[model samples]
Target: MSTAEAVPKMHKACVYDQPGTCSIAIRDVPTPKPGPNEVLIKLTHSGICHSDYAIMMNTWRQLPVPTQTGQIGGHEGLGHIVKLGEGSEKLGVKIGDRVGVKWVASACLACPPCTESLEGYCFNQKVSGYYTPGTFQEYVIGPANYVTPVPESLSGEVGAPMLCAGLTTWYVSKPTVPVLGAGLGRMIYRLPELTVTAVCELLIQNMINIICVILEYSALLKCGASPGQWVVISGAGGGLGTTAVSLAARGMGYRVIGIDMPGKKQDVLDSGAEHFIDVTQFDDATIGKEVKRLTGLGAKAVIVCANSNKAYGQAVSMLRFGGSLVCVGMPEGEQVSIANAYPSSMIMAGHNIVVSAVGNRREAIDVMEMAARGVVKFPVRTVSMSELQSVFEEMSQAKVTGRVVIDFSAA
Candidate 1:
């Protein structure tokens, strides 16, 4: 029988409602047929990234737009193309090929952000897990041109996390550091036969942490950060925070201070942070002093990941003379602006602040190869899709220590 004929009319999907609450229901939604330029993918695995948690709990202050109710909420999916709609074949991707989707569902190419090569901020951006139906279903639909092709050597669970979490850490915010396949123009490389063991090396090169290390390297370079300079990562025990810790310490040769709750100390140490500061032990006034004492002059740069007003307040104080504060988290209902910064405070501080979200598609390719090379490894845990609710609960409680990937074989 033909692939289309064998396709099921109904597929299982995880549906959620009322974004603030983690409300989820597993139901059999009718499978959607591929539309023109779309491809039907039977997903076997998807990663449970913190972005998913942020959406589920309605934590982000700004989404590209508000999420729709009953939208299937997942993006880091790995699967095979089962059927293609009209004109999709022209994209050069074939049926039965493995592919992955990122947080961006689709963007209006005519938007100013797209015109300026910043599709991440496209004015009409449709988020995969928010505005549109995401990859939380057994069968998901994706644009043939936008879906990233999965290499043969990378497994579902292993490659799945790279789609969102890894990409966000390495690519989105860090654009200056060029890695493999960067200069090749048309970052979407022609799919190499999945025959080789060196995964990202073919179209993109290197192994895990490519994007993370390179981006950190770029950020440090941009800030005139030299080796042996002190860099503080406020959420050092969290996902992207841990990555920053690792890249700053191990990759960039920077002395790293990790600031988080007392419980995350060991996790910070494991991630290559030189020192861990227990934020709970110190009041806001004293926390910056401790960091200053530890670094002898405070950190050269402070990357804030804790989604709180206090963290942002402390981040400004945690900097040394001319130090920069980079905010990486968005806490809903919290004040993050340096609006309180008068000219005197900012002038006396001599510090700068910057914000970055996700990276370009080209960077994603570079990092995947590093992962396939088995070099940059993030701590990962596997869970069934049914456990998603519980997982989010643990995350909300600050209980999860590593990246969570869903083994959707049972989904």
Candidate 2:
């Protein structure tokens, strides 16, 4: 093996050092060396995400293991290999190869979950930015076999979100489950069949597409919400909310009432909702009454996408008699008190909650296929790395619409 030149001792990284209580501070920390079958990467771009919020704020409940101080925090990194450790050459990778790291850094493939083709549920998974250091730094290490290989034609900015936020449009993710990521950099992307333009358009529009299956399959055909019935979506401006809006209207032929703060009205309407509910415009109690007034004694179904206990409570009130309340988005806590939080009479009156999370491989294939066929449309926004703090604030306020991507070169 040819020996590489001398490496740097330290590199610039964003450290989670309680810099004002769970705030971030950029520091020069010791650089990491690639060990056996590992590759050292020089990152070109990284995406900012909402899950980054859960990690930085520690809002999620205690885990069997929690992230430590001085750990770098970023998962959607686009970079190239700068150095390789022992045995890395045998993995079909080499120095200067472009790769991406996703939410899962490494998994113990010998575990039952991995063996069963459920690497996502691997008990011994080492998540980037969590268990191991992540790609928030300029240089990060990735396992040779796990890193995703990017097509040479793909740009770092476009490839960055493809590693994550791209596949995530349909799922209602729990903030802590590496819905963001656990590792530095590796990608499984090799779809040369898809052009960069086609992917961008598809990802954006496909974000505008699910939930018909859960509603129809679980609630009995037409028992939940069928064609010509009203289905309300809370948090309709955000990612999953918008997709629910689109699918409920166009895919299932339901009349969609999208409920969000005032700023999201246009995007919600564009997603194919028949109506928009400005939650901020009315008192919390009055909001339910307005929904009833518009949809005639409440909506036939309600999908909760806002990640809050109160949002779930509000969704319960928005449901009509014998209606279904679909719970999609999960808050920071492991379990939220809902269905039972209501009175027994309410439960007996026939209100039910249905939970749906990540989309499976089939779902992914279906969505992408539809997107490639030009069947969906959605808008995407790009943000500079320097604007990450504001991005979190926008998310916290629910002011942003559609999808957002992080451009690491801006860092």
Candidate 3:
């Protein structure tokens, strides 16, 4: 509501000066003027995604480069639209309207992927925090077509993660109707059932907590899941895993069996998982045996939200005949083709394996609204924007439990 004259001359931003180095500084860059069909947002809070840390650390080489020099590094941004650019009227965006900017900033409408609403893989797409200046800065320019509108009910902080992590899971965890008499059809149970053998390698040892990121919990409540359906959630204490457990169990009325370390049992139970498996202490073979014992026919579907080769292999081994394995996590190292060795026989027996990179955006508005209504809870730790560098360090070391959000208001 304030005039341009009332705004500060310069705002603080966290910039990646080089691959592996991030610094917070007050820069005198001019306020970015919005382009045609674009709107300017004054961001309040942004979630520090693990992928952002990966990009900053140059852990992955596939990221886009929009600037040869340093660039801003954040994608999950929730803020208010404070200014309109030329031709923005056609976009239907308004001043003070809360909105979110995500990784997929804009996609060329002419692309084949765009035509199919598969903008996540749009060939000529621009990415925030990668190819474009992202939300780490106080003000950001967002394209009309791709930006997410935050509803009036949710706070900016709670709405931030939905643009990325939440969307990824929303896309992967959606229920599928298996062919009748197939793996899921054989179960003949009312509630959705999931079975998986979870194995976690102890790369780092600490009392790490789990955090779940949700767009909206109430929308998930309306999904019509019933009791007795079994849902297996790996990384059940982490952001994505916890959210899946909460929605699948608490909101949808499904029975949740959490897969994580034994120490994470309390947190997993707190998130509504009916059972917990201490994955760190178990071996792959042990997990498979345990899964078979827990679910007689095996799990109907397995949602792979953790990014590890071991997890993928375990997921494949744990699935029952004709069951589905939904791939959500990406490999941190070289992209490897799905191993043929694990369940070579399962495919022949009618098993289904599916991969989804990001959740459907059309569902985001509804999902975020659920959080606003207090139907779903997002557990997060608020950190000052100035602590971003250290946060990355903690993330790299696996010392953090749950999601770490950067409070830009501290700037």
Candidate 4:
């Protein structure tokens, strides 16, 4: 059957009434018609991400624009292309094709970042669910050139998480892993003078210097971490955390230690981590000691996927001298202030830090291909479309076990 003929009107979606809360409200919104250079997606499943919580709370400053009241709140969606608007053919999009819709809904190619193929950092970008509307609806619109094609071999539920969480995590951590050994030969390796425990002790007093300037800025700049190095992923039980584990271990071939709660140890290991650590069982000395014990050195890179301010501060404590730490998640209203001595401390420590925003089409395509080939697996729990309100409550309570995907077809 023609893909358009297969799409039905009045599909189901979850809408949020206000920030910090969400519920399922049925609305008679029209099925969006694709525009030139656009494609209409008949969505099957959409995974709720941690950032969705921020959207629900109306706290994120980087949203394409402030979300309107009763806005739809999902970006990681999987669907089939039902119709291609005029000019979409040139982009190679076709009917009946499975595709993944991610956080970045649109970016102006003329911008310096976009021209350089760094669309994730584009100053002028629109986000799904924030600016141009989102994929929570049964039928949504997407850019033909921007969407990642999903393999038929992958399930819709699995494909859903790869769109945003998988792609973002992969993109953020990819630069740290070595590829054919081309990059790091020019870089110098230096160990930090202060240990993680020392950093922890000074954390309360030197909060601004250690977390913001030294750990956040220097790690991404001076460390020059490469592939084949050890990486530690914090908060490994959650959606983005799982993606970091799989991408670092399987995709990039880095030795990864996934750290989370004790109950998540097995899940972390299943995500291709070489080792796992339950944070509750460990003291400040545990992570660095274990990391050094396992690799004869501390982590070459640390990816912070936890939303707590403490996680962000402690991530640097796990790094080796000259290693890098990447910060991805943060809690609302919690300040991340690095102390004034960061430049000198980082110079003495010889490490770097980077704060990356999550929106990269090239890296998204790379990771999605990994998902399509079954190289990376994402575990998800499905809920009927009607249960979105309860799901939000569960999320607020930290009761969610894994990625939660809403099955729109249940409508």
Indicate which candidate wins on TM-score: 4
Error of 3 at 97 (Å): 0.5
**Residue 178 in model 3: lDDT:** 11
**TM-score of each candidate?**
0.81, 0.65, 0.81, 0.82
After aligning candidate 4 to the native by TM-score, how far in Å is the CA of 300 from where it should be?
A: 0.3
- In model 2, which range of ten residues has the least summed lDDT? 179-188
Residue 7, candidate 1: C-alpha displacement in angstroms: 3.0
lDDT per residue as tens, model 4, 104-168 = 77777779999866787778887788755777778888889888888788877777888877777
**Candidate order by decreasing lDDT:** 4, 1, 3, 2
Error of 2 at 282 (Å): 4.8
**Model 1, TM vs. native:** 0.81
Count of residue pairs whose backbone atoms collide, per candidate:
12, 14, 17, 19
lDDT of 3 by residue, 1-411 (tens): 434323455666777876655444435456777888898888888988877876776656554432334678888898888778888868777777788887777778678876775778788877788868888888888986667878777866667877776676655544322111112323434234433321122111111211111223322211222245565676776666766676566544567677875655777788787778888767877876676678776665667666666777787666666666767666575666665435558757567776666544565665576556655554677778778888888766655555677777763
Better of 3 and 4 by lDDT: 4
Task: Report, for every candidate in turn, its global Cα lDDT versus the true structure.
Answer: 0.72, 0.65, 0.66, 0.72
Runs of candidate 3 exceeding 4 Å displacement: 1-9, 21-28, 61-69, 175-228, 339-343
Give the residue spans of candidate 1 off by over 4 A: 1-6, 59-66, 172-175, 180-228, 250-253, 334-342
Q: What clash count does candidate 1 reach?
A: 12
lDDT of 1 by residue, 297-338 (tens): 888878877666778888877788888777666676534565
